[model samples]
Target chain A: MTEKEIQVREKQEVQQAGEPTKPERYFVPPVDIYETDEDVTVLADMPGVAKDGVEVRLEDDTLTIKGTKGGNGGEGERVLLREFESGHYLRRFTIAEIIDQAKIEATMVDGVLTLKLPKVEPAKPRKIVVQGG
Target chain B: MAIIRFTDRPLFRNPWADFERMRREFDALFQGLTGEYPRQVGGTVYPALNISEDADHLYVRAEIPGVKAADLDISVEGDTLTISGERATGPAEQRFSYHRREIECGRFSRAITLPTRVNPDQVGAGFVNGVLTIILPKAETAKPRKIEIKTQ
Candidate 1:
């Protein structure tokens, strides 16, 4: 069997119109979103970000995920070759109303964050017999 | 009296900014000199590397999320360091419809040439938060030595 090579992607700098307050550069983390029968799952890759540095917020149908990474390399050490830059991770998605906001859960492991948003169950159909008045 | 000597190059340096300009020149010069082209002018290489050096050791780091330590393989042969690993996701039991699939999971390997010779026996590595850091001690022959001045 032939082995597949994972393609390399440079971190993309986040650019939002009319939002100039953020001075430090933030990168758009690559994510995978999937939906099963019960809930939707989101997996984002944010390396070098510890558990305390990650924050997930959901408000007004918008879900935002942020991760901050500290500076790398030691003092007095000179860089020889650099192929990537360390920065904060930011991404936002518009969540549907069918999701159950109270049951959303998030967990991070080895710099990858996994979020689960459970869908609201639809009301079951009921049969009713009306008594003669 | 102790004599203090300063190097010619400035201490505060940013090499990445210069590398971008130098890469373009080297690409153009190589194409002009030889009809065959090397790698792409501006393209992403797999498993991006950040190499840094101090007086004693050289550090190499790579960001590889969702890769387990058991799946990774690292080797140092002479002046070449090879990093290979596989990123495995959840099992294929539950089939779910994907809305947006950007993260790719597969096997990848990259070999880097060290700028200076290193002692392969004394190399060390660690993985934390999906980032792999490797420390290689410089060989004795490659380290700088100061000569003593003798007056008769």
Candidate 2:
């Protein structure tokens, strides 16, 4: 085939890690975290998760992200090829004290969750001008 | 006596990289010990796919997170269905540093040879919540037909 074939990867199920209180299978959603001067942003890929199904929580220094996938195929659909399995998502991160928890903002778009943690104002550097005597 | 001042500055190296590397090592070790890892081939593809079918239509679903519908292109030729698209990178800023970078962003194209023949003109596709679904209606020749029993 001249065209490059997209590889198939099965989602890794979350096992022996952060077991949810509810009895449901979960997968570790892949994430990307980048830091700018003002804030540190986190982008997580939670496919099939709608805006109403995702939840973000910050307790102490741990940031937790959880998302529930809606559903797979339509009614009475037969499976021909099952490379990917649908499941809920769960992941946690240890945030630093420099982040201003009060100003953290999160948004979901197209099954991707973006969390922006702005830096505390006091932590930013300030310039001091000197007056010549 | 001199005092050393500490400031809340970003680390030079990404801390998450260590965690990821260690996790991969652990996974490899466990896979070697048990020889029963679900995904024998590690890492990931551009877009993972799942194919299902109904009586009339064959559905092909792909998970392409962070991809916009406008950036995707789907074409069908004969028995081959191709999904090609570019996943744009995060905000364009040279000053930004990354703690964890796992998302793959670039031009990606995947072509699949459908299990059965489909009507090229009737193919329909939709994108929602980072998932792209293409519904390919089976050709008339491919659908099952029933014949009434003739009695003497």
Candidate 2 lDDT over B1-152, as tens digits, reads 86645555554759787887687678656754662223323335556667778889999988888888898999999999998887787788588888898666677887789999999999999888988899999999888778899999
Indicate the residue-level lDDT of B32 in model 1: 44
Model 2: how far residue A104 lies from native, Å: 1.7
Per-residue accuracy of model 1 over B1-152 as CA lDDT, tens digit each: 86656785578867685886687568547754553222332336578887788988999989989998889999999999999989885647368988888888888988978999999999999988888999999999988888999999
- Which residue pairs of candidate 1 clash? none
Error of 2 at B46 (Å): 3.6
| CAPRI-style class, candidate 1 | acceptable
| Candidate 1: stretches off by over 4 Å | A17-23, B1-43
Each model's chain A TM-score:
0.89, 0.79
Best by DockQ: 1
Candidate 2 wrong stretches, greater than 4 Å: A1-10, A17-23, A123-133, B1-45
The value of fnat for model 2 is 0.69
lDDT of each residue in A68-108, candidate 1, tens digit only: 88766555777677677777899999987478888999988
Output the worst ten-in-a-row residue range by lDDT, candidate 1 chain B. Answer: B34-43
Candidate 2 lDDT, A65-129, residue by residue in tens: 99988876555776666556667899989988477878989999987999998987665677999
